[model samples]
Target: MYIDGALTDGQGRIDVINPATEDSVATVAAAGFADVERALAAARDAFPGWAATPIAERQRWMRRLRDEVIANEDDLRACVHHEMGKPWAQTEEDWDRVVASLDFYAEEIARLQDFSLPDRAGTHSHRMVWEPAGVAVAFLAWNFPLLNLAFKLGPAMAAGCPIIIRPSNETPISAYAIGELCAGIGLPRGVVQVLATETYAAADALSASTIPAVLTMIGSTETGKHVIRTGATSIKKYAMELGGNAPVLVFDDADLDLAADVVCGVKFSNAGQICVSPNRVYVQRSVLQAFTDRAVARARAARVGFDRDDDITTGPLINARAFDRIKGLVDRAVAEGATLLAGGDRPQGMNRGHFLAPTVLGDVTETMDVYRDETFGPIVSIIPFDTEDDLLRQANDCGQGGLTAYVFTRDLARAEGYAAALRYGEVQINGVKYDIDLPHGGIGYAGVGHDCSYLALHDYLVLKRITRARDTTLFESVNA
Candidate 1:
């Protein structure tokens, strides 16, 4: 752990255990309030110099970090795989995405350059300069550990702000690797810190202090709400990427084969642990039987186990709590008369790990608990909708709004209509994928903040508007 510009040990250490083998992977210092205080002091001390660093110089460091990340691709992949049990392919893809985002910031660095607005009706021109908010506390979730960090840290680095990152207890190796890489590239002293711990002492301390100018977190909605309440007193700038209950719609005319394949990948990837994974599938009644049959077959064909050897479709749930929640949802849905189309039981072979079979449910009604809650596992519920309006209502009825809705329709007009009707951050038409340049977020309960593209940049920045008189002499004449 890096505290007060020094690498120091905490009062105690926490063992990071692999959920797959139930073995200790590594031990990390579980920092105390004292350690947190020291980190905050370092952040406060480093702020002025970091904020004053040239944006160009900051951009250069980010570029170097980006190159380092790409060069050490295999190392990152291995870490994410064993730590989070994520598939090797997905981990590599995540590394690619991180590099792409860094490239995006580097290519768009000019946006941070101070500029003078064209004089329209004023003798004095308007000026705009992007300033570092100060210190930023990045709270990362266990899933997609490094990817979430990139979302917060990339922009902060570009803006020349120091960063303190708290990686989740479940997965911290890759994040720690990132920290070490940054240090090797010589991130200014106190500019960035990464700590792995069971207790959120580091983050809690930063939230309660004045050193953190901005706080960015990626976690559950519950956690996001907690941060909001705690960070209220300090009145620091905050950004969040919380949980999501995304939905996939298969219209009557959709190609069942294509829809089944794409949706299988999206819903079960990362063991259905992703915030944007499509949790609920609405199949039009006209093709419901065919769709369910194909989807179930595809799912059954999906391999389940460790990501290391089996290029499996799914892996273990993050922990016992995640598995319990998933099982609870399944129980609730079955009691409410929902049919288990496939995969209701746990895998027969696995007994030690927190593994869950890829599950698919049918005859699921909107009133059922499975339809109303986010399972956050390799569990998906299928509901049948009769009409366009009905499906739209079913999709948008949940309190959570940070959903990613998908519509599979060959008809362009139908696709357009469904896309327009869904209240989500990003809607995919005919099973298309999300582009990094697109604005992503949800309406209502999904999330309050947006990520990706220039729209995301707005959250990390504050704009200042200056107005001036066309002529100073004219203003004096008016007074005279």
Candidate 2:
């Protein structure tokens, strides 16, 4: 655990396993009740001072951290690669996000300034001020360990709020490494703390505490609800990026190759653990066969291996449980009449790792569990549609959440209509893009707040209004 600007021991330790090898990569500190309390207290103690620090000084520290991240890029990448069994190439995205977020937020905070609001009666001058929301507690998901941490840490630090990060137990080694870097830079005590807890009791202690004014997380919707329910001890601000069942709509006139490339690219990346990964792909009936063929070709060509030099595309699931769950989904889908078009079981010649071959299923219906639930694995279910109305209805019928929707079409008018009518937060036409400068969030169960762009800063800030009565004589003199 990293607390009070130092690396310290916890009451217990959790052994982190590499999914590729199913071997213990490292053991990380696991916080107990006492440790959680100490971390909360430290954050409470440091909040005021950290918030009072000048923006320029805060920016300096952020840039310093960014520099450290850049200097130790390889080590950080290795941590993620080994800890989660993520492909070496995929780990690059994790590393890049950490660096980009720090750099982006540091400059973004400097752009913030007080806003002047006009008084309708012209009797007073009013200004809106932004201030740190106070102590923050962040819960991260394990899929993209560093990337998820970057989304929370960058904003909280830049906004001048002290944060305590509780990374998922399944992958904490990378987060622990980040703590070491913070200690090396002499970050202020309690300004940033990273710890993992094995027990739900200790983890709940963080949310249950009244010290945290903001509770943010990146995880499942049920977990988000649980946090808000437990953290209701106070009126705390919540910003969560939860589960998503993103949909992809492919029109008959669309570029089939481009669509397949994108779908396969996203589905196989990180073994399709991404929140915004395309869950249900709806292709026009006329071109259903064309789309599926391309998708299968890409899936069959995807290299699944652990060696860094192998240029691996797909990797292992986080653990045995995840592997079983994904495999069961595939088995159930096949049993229910869906045609297995490509890889479904584990890749041949690989028996030790928790790897699942990239799977593509066709003729899938909404009634199937594979289509109904968010399949956070390397599986793509293709559903065919005859008309735009039916496609729109099925696409928007996402009960899990609506984070993102993709459309591949050459018709600009049709694309614009779908983009506007789609219920998801993001609609990508022809291509997909996500970066630190764009707002990333969703509607419904997906989440409540933004994770990127200047908008994300709102989650860590409180708005204050200051008004002063204008004197009539002073106004007249100024006018003259």
Candidate 3:
């Protein structure tokens, strides 16, 4: 972990294993209780000066950090690839997001100026000002660590909040890589640091320390709950992007080929580890079989491998635990009478790492485990529905609020109706889109807070109201 512009050991160390090969890649030092406190203390020490920095200077640093990440893109890409088994191309896209975020926030800082409120009378005035919330911490999930870091880091820094990021032990190297980049840009010591904690005990202790006035995290819903429950003592504000069972609706009139190709491609991308990957596919009963056939063909044709082979469409799961967890979902779904239309086993002839075939389960029901829970792997549950009302009920019945809904329909009315009715943070009709401009966050259990937009900076800002009494002379005269 990088703390105060230096690399130091903490409680102990852990081996970062290559998920694809299940071989040790690196040994990363962990931040113990004392070390975490020192890191937090350093951030606290640096916060006032950094918060006082003019926005232009802050933006200059942001741009420099962005450029540093871009220049070291290859090294970062290799770290992400080796750490998480993501294909090189996918890692490149992640780095693209890293650069895009810095550029986006650096440009946006000048636009978020402090302002004064209207005065009620000539004697009284009110001014509204935004100030940094001191220190902040972001807990990252391993799947897209770099992108998630950008999600929190850019906005927090842009808002003038010093940050301490705790990367997932599963993929900790990339966080160190980012910390080193910030150091290269000559960011004030402790303004940005990475806490590579090896144990849940250490991470929980650090987050619960009350030093960080603002907290942000991107991870599973259960994990988010734990963060909230444990970190409640400080009463610090939180921004979280938790678990998602992204639902896709394929209306009967939709183009079957386009819908099938995109749905299958997305569900299997990154082995379906993406929080917003379309998980439940509800097809109109009339075209269910046709769509299922097309989707099954797409799934069956997907290749799983170790590298970015032109033929590969999916990669290995993060680790053995992920592989087994997803495998159990498939097995239980099958045992409960769901038809395995395409894949339910490992790819043939190769069996070493955490690889699973792209799978499609047909005739799935709302009662199945696969339907009720997040698989978080290369699997999709397809259920046929005849009525729009029934489909809507099924779509909206997710236990939690963190969902992304997709609608594929040619009719304008149908599209608009579904768009308005879907209970998810983001809705995509006909095409998929995510960028720095749109606000992305969960509504209910998906967790609090948002990412990527100017709104993100609001999370790190503390609003202050300044009131001026200009008519003091009238009161003084009356008193005399």
Which of the numbered candidates is closest to the native, going by highest TM-score? 2
Candidate 1 per-residue lDDT over residues 61-171, each given as its tens digit: 778989999999999888888887776777876677678777776556557556678886556768786666778887889888777777766666666677888888888
TM per prediction: 0.92, 0.97, 0.96
What's the residue-level lDDT of 3 in candidate 1?
Answer: 56
Work out candidate 2's RMSD over C-alphas.
Answer: 2.5
Worst lDDT window (10 residues) for model 3?
304-313
| Better by TM-score, candidate 3 or 1 | 3
Q: Give the clashing residue pairs of candidate 1, or none.
A: 400-446, 401-445, 401-446, 402-446, 425-441
Query: Residue 432 in candidate 2 has what lDDT?
Result: 91
TM-score computed on alpha carbons, candidate 2: 0.97
User: Can you tell me which runs of candidate 3 are displaced by over 4 Å?
Assistant: 119-123, 470-480
Clashing pairs in 3: none
Stretches of candidate 1 above 4 Å error?
4-6, 112-124, 466-480
CA lDDT of every candidate = 0.77, 0.93, 0.86
